[model samples]
Target: MDETDQAIVRLLQADGRLGHREIAEIVGLSRSAAAGRINRLIESGQVIVRGVVHPAVLDRNSLAHVGLVVRGPAEPVAALIAAREDCPFVSLTSGPHAIVAELRTSSAHELDEALSGLRGLDGVQGVETLSYIEVLRDVVGPVGETDHRIDDVDAALLHVLQSDGRASYVDLAAHVRLTPAGVRRRVLRLLDAGVVRIGALVRQPGRDGQAAMGIGLRVSGDPRDLLEQLGALPQASFLARTLGRYDLILTLRAYDPAEMLHGLEQVRGLDGVTETVSWTHLRVVKETYAFEGLAP
Candidate 1:
């Protein structure tokens, strides 16, 4: 991805639902120009813009991650299953030797049905279930754009900030070819407009920093309310509900097994939580969001 692509990614990362005019104003491109760029990005499969609703919030508690350890091959199975709308995340690797997928649904019974569908698949062998007690969502690749405003200078500033949020006002001013005050004002506008999420990229320490342990949860009560309450917690890094043994699936970081177990316990102890399963970070193998390429 080049400079322009990175800028687009940043804007979407902050607000995937941003409109064409808003993106154009910030990217310093014409409305048509921005539209064309977004179209190309979407067509190329480099970015996916969608409304990821918490299934439980919608009363669909069937969510699951099916870790498939096949015998003969994996590529075909991965390709075949990736087409499922319920299959939001897919990964392929040979370490644990399998093609694993993170699937979603609305309830546990639906999850059983989904599993039945998977088990009926030709190459599928085994399945491990992880229950998600809580799911935390963040701006991974843009969501919606209720708040956004960008001008030529603002777009230039955002381009710089995505590369380094800590860049000084003076440095940003120089890079964007704007006066110090102009750059500062634009920066303030971006913040006020919510074009970029400003926060520390803090690591939880140890291997946890390197691996995203996926956990699934089965819960009771109003599943969506439970997910919303859990999503509001500080420890939740990523959260979603699916169909299977668990109603929710989440990613977390920890130092060791003990930490992971502790985190799992905390999740299981929630008011409406029924149970949970903690999976070791065997391997991420596949994640489109982790591509980190503004351009493919």
Candidate 2:
């Protein structure tokens, strides 16, 4: 990606619903040129802009990370883990474990059933799970908004953009019987209300040998101070305070194993952190930004 592409990506990263005109003004390009650049980014698999529902609106609220030790090649097992609807993230990495997967379910029973199913998969050796009590922060936006109360028209727009964040205003208007301008207005209202978040979902560029890792920190002291410190780190992506065997869950992306290890050590060395466990994410199979709440 070039400098202009990078700037565009950054803007969309903040707000995928931004207009080409707004993006052009910020990035110093013609409106058409900005639109074309966004299209290229989407087509090149560099970014995906879409409407992401708050977990509060979903039936599946339980979230957990599972680490797997495979008996043979990890790719096939990763594929199997990826195929499951609840397993949104599956990776094969070089670490203490062979495969790592993230599971989202509606209840504790569902979580257990999903983990059991993973254990029963062919070539699976063992499974370790870390259930999330709560997510403090995520890639999409802040947590703790459980207002599943959108009206029919707004719901329709969300359903449409749940699949295509960059869906045209005309198409959305047709779906909801609004004018193109009306659709644009409603979208902005929803975004401003924090009822929905739209942004590009892109993989961490591996150009610099970057790797993503999951860290479980066991904390004995007040977590706020430690969380603030960890949150400021550049590599930190997802940070959560949990109530399981571990107190905090962190997701970080580093240039390589050494950096990843160093990052872990830095967390381990923090004041509130008592112990630490880490896993590397090799591949991400499915991300659950799309929602079923607005579906018919």
Candidate 3:
């Protein structure tokens, strides 16, 4: 969107839970005014507010990503994919599968079970999966910079932390050229302000060595509520609100598709959940959460 909106996104990308007031301080705007702008950005489809879960630490087993190559026109197949709550970050672009998504989870067993469910889908097409063995880096921040209100320090903080969410206060202080405590204060402000949230990521699904499966969910309830339920569950990760064909997009790791199906069954007639679609990942070459910025 516009510069102000981009600034808001930049702030939230660092931490989705940041409040309008803190964001206003970072972005040089009034709290109410910053909130108005953020609301507008979300309404315009340029940015969204969502809670992000760290799968690596949260789940002992985790699902990295899945590639779905359907057998028909991309639109309808994409629509089916979109409706499922488990398939949160989907992209229907110029690719072999017509639809690609980064499924986040930590269970090897759950991952396998989800694959079976995907094979059962009516489309009757091919599926490919890629699992991330090593996460070189991960960042949660806006990708591009169209927002001009942010200062150099703020921008640098966004850029650096997007690659490493757990950067220490000492490192941040050094990079930002502030005292360690100063950096810590700023970081605390960022978190309290909702500019960013930091937590340990569960690299796998279960401590018992069970596999995790990635399931995509499309729900009828407020996407946020559905995400809250899934995120609160010990198996889900990588929740997002998207546009194009779905109201919300999310990824979850379960002991197996049955458990996921069971989860869906539990959530199914609820006012918030409508449908859940799952796909097991075959392989993952590259997966990064580093801010790639906005899509032009």
Candidate 4:
């Protein structure tokens, strides 16, 4: 992707519903040219525009990261875990643990059940879980309150958006038997309430001259101050306060290994940080925010 493509991707990442003309104005291209480029990007599988449902929408509020120590080949185990709906983000890492997966569940009981299910999988020797206390930053926009109300019509609209975020208001109105104006109002309400986010999900983004790592920090002093400091870094993608072997967990992306090293060193030098552990993501097996069966 060239600079223009990258800029378009960034714009869509922020708002997937951006019109071709709007993007064209920002990227200094003709409207037709911008539309062509966006179409090409989607057709070539470089970018995907979809609505990411907030966990709060479905009452699936509990979030945790589970690292697994596989007895043998990690791919087979990783594949098995990747197939599970609850484990949305899964990867094979170069570190103490071979596989790491994120589990999204509704309650403590559900989380326990999911962990027990993972323990029963073959080649799973041990499991380490990190429960998120507060998510300072999330890739899918802010994690909003869980009390957002939605009816059957709203769920249907969300389901359609999940498949095609840029679906025209007229098209959406057809799905729910509402007028285009009413449909637009409903969609805007959902977006403004933070119940759903329409954005671009790039596949294998690290292939674009980038390196990513997961860092686990053990902090001694008040973590609030440290969280604010770390969360402000440009490289930080996902940041959270957690309970487990680490107090704070985050993911960083950089242009090269030296830059990654520099970012790591910067984190280490922070005042409250006591110890730090990090793992390089060898491969991301499954990273999805789409919640299936939206209608409830």
lDDT values of the candidates? 0.58, 0.77, 0.50, 0.86
**Of models 2 and 4, which has the larger lDDT?**
4
State the lDDT at 234 in candidate 2.
63
Q: Write the per-residue lDDT of candidate 1 for residues 93-173, one digit (tens) a residue.
A: 434437667656767777777777777678888776655443346424222242454456655555555444446678988
Q: Model 1, residue 258: what's the lDDT?
A: 66
True-vs-predicted CA distance for residue 277, candidate 1, Å: 3.6
Clashes of each: 31, 1, 67, 0
Which scores better on TM-score, 3 or 4? 4
- What is candidate 3's CA lDDT for residue 222? 57
Runs with alpha carbons beyond 4 Å of true place in candidate 1: 1-136, 139-145, 200-211, 232-234, 241-246, 283-296
Candidate 2: misplaced stretches above 4 Å? 28-32, 203-211, 254-269
Question: lDDT (0-100) at residue 82 of candidate 4?
Answer: 90
TM-score of 2: 0.84
- By TM-score rank, best first, the candidates go 4, 2, 1, 3
Model 1 alpha-carbon miss at residue 70, Å: 6.3
Candidate 4 ranges with C-alpha deviation above 4 Å: 254-262
| The best candidate in terms of lDDT | 4
Misplaced by over 4 Å in model 3 are 43-46, 56-60, 83-86, 136-296
In Å, residue 16's CA in model 2 sits off its true spot by 1.3
